[model samples]
Target chain A: MSFSLKKDKQGVVVVGVDGQLIVGNRQELKQKVLDTLESGGRKFVIDFTKTGYIDSSGLGVLVSLSKKIREQGGDLRLCGLNEDLQTLFELTKLDTLFAIARTPEEALAAF
Target chain B: MTQPQPPQPPQPLHVRRRATGGDTELSLDVPSDLDYVGRAVELIADQLPGGPLSPRRIRFNFRTAFAEALANAIAYGNHRDPGRVVHVRVEVAHDAVRVHVTDEGNGFDPKGVPDPTLPERLEREDGRGLFVLKSLMDQVAFNEKGNSVCLTLRAG
Candidate 1:
């Protein structure tokens, strides 16, 4: 559906991924993140508060962006991960990799 | 003589068709079904007759695999077929439990899926479904001729 990207002066991009993240919108998500990166925004706080569910494809896009951002000497962070996604991350062990914060404020300040 | 056989009642196409003929065959239907997936693992675990630790272990493996498959089939499958039902069948053979979850959507290309465990892609959610299924199940396969997928979990 409609994904919105909001940026503050801090250069920490706050992305709101709404609705479901399935196979179809996965590429859009990747492009959106890359576009944000190209625009000189590196440290990111992806808000998953509205994201009820995300499949494997969506997860892949996030990882792809994470790698892209990492190469630029910046890091991508995740915030508001739901219990289900958290469970998945815990199960997959990727939870250990990302800097997760409870809120956007916490994430932006983490770096 | 052969013409007299035509007097018999008509049979539905699905009924007239043969079973996949591997093992057990099950049929299920989903309605407004919110939670959607239920008892999928218990069904598979029941395939194991008995042992001290068999049920629990089988339950764990089958539950993980079953939840992932059903979640995809329900979450992704429903988007493609709104208000459509998902039918599941399981064949319990001596070697493994073969499960088929059929949906109303067009078939998918499984080979196009990417690997999840590659160091670079580890953070993604997209590659996890099949990877999790493959990791949990002995073998997983798709048959779209009838919009069905057959996944197998080994039995001890």
Candidate 2:
């Protein structure tokens, strides 16, 4: 899986994955989150609209990043999760853990 | 293990698209046209001998297994060489399909992952890759050879 990141409106960072997020690339994704945090951005809105699918590892990466940001006084929200991935979030109760929105703007507004 | 393209053609995919097999193979080399693993699973499912299955089941399992194996190959397999080759083989028999996805990267110790179900892990978001694979597939096995890892999954 490949990802592109950009900061939007000073508070939101958009992360897009080119394809599925599986076991192998979770570390890279997690590092992206850490890098963003180290660079002074706290609020994030990860966009999964372009991502085809994601498994537990991908989910874990999101969770780990979100947790780390939260501990550092920042917050992360997820947007555009497809049906299958949305179900996974709900099943694992991650939906409750992270602030999830229907769109990037909504996620940004949430913070 | 080696796939030779025709002398004058962009037919590798077209030919493989038509060929059916009981072999379980996942190629990490992304074909420009078929980049996503979902498409690969569809291609593999089409080649299965059974007439067909419920669209929902097929779609579900395809998403699950494809998400698990293909992601690993893409993210973990070619980390060192940037441009590395990953091969996948599938064995479809009467009861189930056994798929083997091999990568060119060193495999990790599976035992290192924590159980997400542990009380302390209830709020943690990581450490669920293999767990989910084990839960979804009938079986999942990992083997290491030099810099390559062979991931096996069984689904009946």
Candidate 3:
């Protein structure tokens, strides 16, 4: 429902989501990331520490964004997924396609 | 002698509860708008807390699956037509909860929906809703029309 964006010392863009990501607000998140990608911001991290739920639409946007970023020679990482979210990613088999980190620092370091 | 009662018009949202068995039923008729999907799921899922289902199960599994069903009904089923209404009915019993989501649009065959998990289809943005809801719910069933779906979650 809410998002926070900051640049780390290593120039990685860290975006934090603070609520459920469903069809209602997925476009906003997608556009924000797309806009960032267009602005030459490459390395990215989405923090889900405060996020409680995400539907298929939310996952779709993440996939779309990740593909776009990768196609443009950039990379995106995700961190701070709760147990439920981890299971969701596994259930959808997206865990194999995404680079997941345990923390924002880990994501930033990986990039 | 019993008197005949007048027919009542449908409301946007209606809730009925049975006092004897602690059973609750909620029905919602909302325009096919994505904005109403999250709130509707919240309202329905709120009824399950402190009951037979655990908080984690209700929070993640039920909420996620229910939200997907509503989104599918509003967006894909009704094609986001404001004139068309999406009907949702939720019944919560002592041991389980069942939800029915029906849309105004023509139905499709669930069998035709391809696997999103296949290696060839990983990057597709859509088509994952059905898979996610089915994975989260204990049982998923579709009517012959396919425009209506029933999702059931049982307490352990």
Candidate 4:
């Protein structure tokens, strides 16, 4: 997975990930989250509109990142997940663990 | 103990094709590489009959199950060793699609896989692959050795 980060007018960081998020690129994704956290961007939104695939490994990274961010008194929201990803999150019951918004704007506004 | 045989040279990844009547069957011997999982998913998607499934169902079910099975084979079965091979066989019938994925690694007990649906297991990063496969596919079964997985999807 490759990501581009931009902060919104509210200073909430919006991370747009392109391509598949699988075991092959999960480390890079984790590092991106860590780096963003280190740079003091607390509120976050992960945009998954263009991300076509995700596996257990990818979900793992997201879960871990959510936990870490929460522990640090920050919040993360997910937005733009296509149908398949939404079903995946539901199947694994991860939907309960995340705050999902329909659009990036909603996610940004959530913070 | 039997003397350990010299490590055989790694098997080259290749696909074997067979055509019978109007049906097409393919078998792929891929090196235990995670990168090939996406390629495999794409190949399967390309071969699926177009009339029975919507594009969204195709992506949600077939690709998801296939990717999970391949990931398990490489990560748990082959331990991510490139020298190992994961054999995948796909048969596209008129009414159903069947895929068999076998790995070279020592098998584990499929029955013992954790229940990801339980609230306690929800936050864990791992253990969801099999659950997803079982949830989406019409049928998912493991061989006696637990090293091979068979997934089937029936046409609606």
- In terms of TM-score, the best-performing candidate is 3
Off by over 4 Å in 2: B1-60, B66-115, B134-156
What lDDT score is found at residue B76 in candidate 3? Answer: 81
- 2 or 4, which is superior by TM-score? 4
**Candidate 3 A-chain TM-score:** 0.96
Q: Could you tell me the lDDT of residue B15 within candidate 3? A: 46
> Given candidate 4, what's the lDDT at residue B76?
92
For each candidate, what's the DockQ? 0.15, 0.28, 0.68, 0.59
- The TM-score obtained for chain B by all candidates, in the order given, is 0.68, 0.64, 0.85, 0.84
Model 3 residue B35 distance off true place after TM-score fit, in angstroms: 1.5
lDDT of 4: 0.84
Q: Which consecutive 10 residues in model 1 chain A have the weakest lDDT in total?
A: A51-60
Higher-scoring candidate on DockQ, 1 or 3:
3
lDDT of 2 by residue, A10-106 (tens): 7578888876675556678888879989999888888888776677767877777877899999888889886767777766667777778887778
Q: Please identify model 4 stretches exceeding 4 Å from their true place.
A: B1-14, B47-52
Model 4, residue B43: displacement in angstroms? 3.7
Candidate 2: tens digits of C-alpha lDDT, residues B8-76: 543233213223464333232443222344555556656654522344434555456656665566565
Per-residue lDDT of A36 in model 4? 86
CAPRI classification of candidate 1: incorrect
- CAPRI-style quality class for the chain A–B interface of candidate 3: medium
For B1-156, candidate 1 gives per-residue lDDT tens digits of 555545543222121112455544545554313243433333444443443224533544555556556666666666535467667666566566666777776666778777766676665545588776675567788875435567776665
Query: Residue A103 of model 2: what lDDT?
Result: 77
Most DockQ-accurate candidate = 3
What's the candidate order when arranged by decreasing DockQ?
A: 3, 4, 2, 1
Best candidate according to lDDT: 3
**What's the residue-level lDDT of A76 in candidate 2?**
82
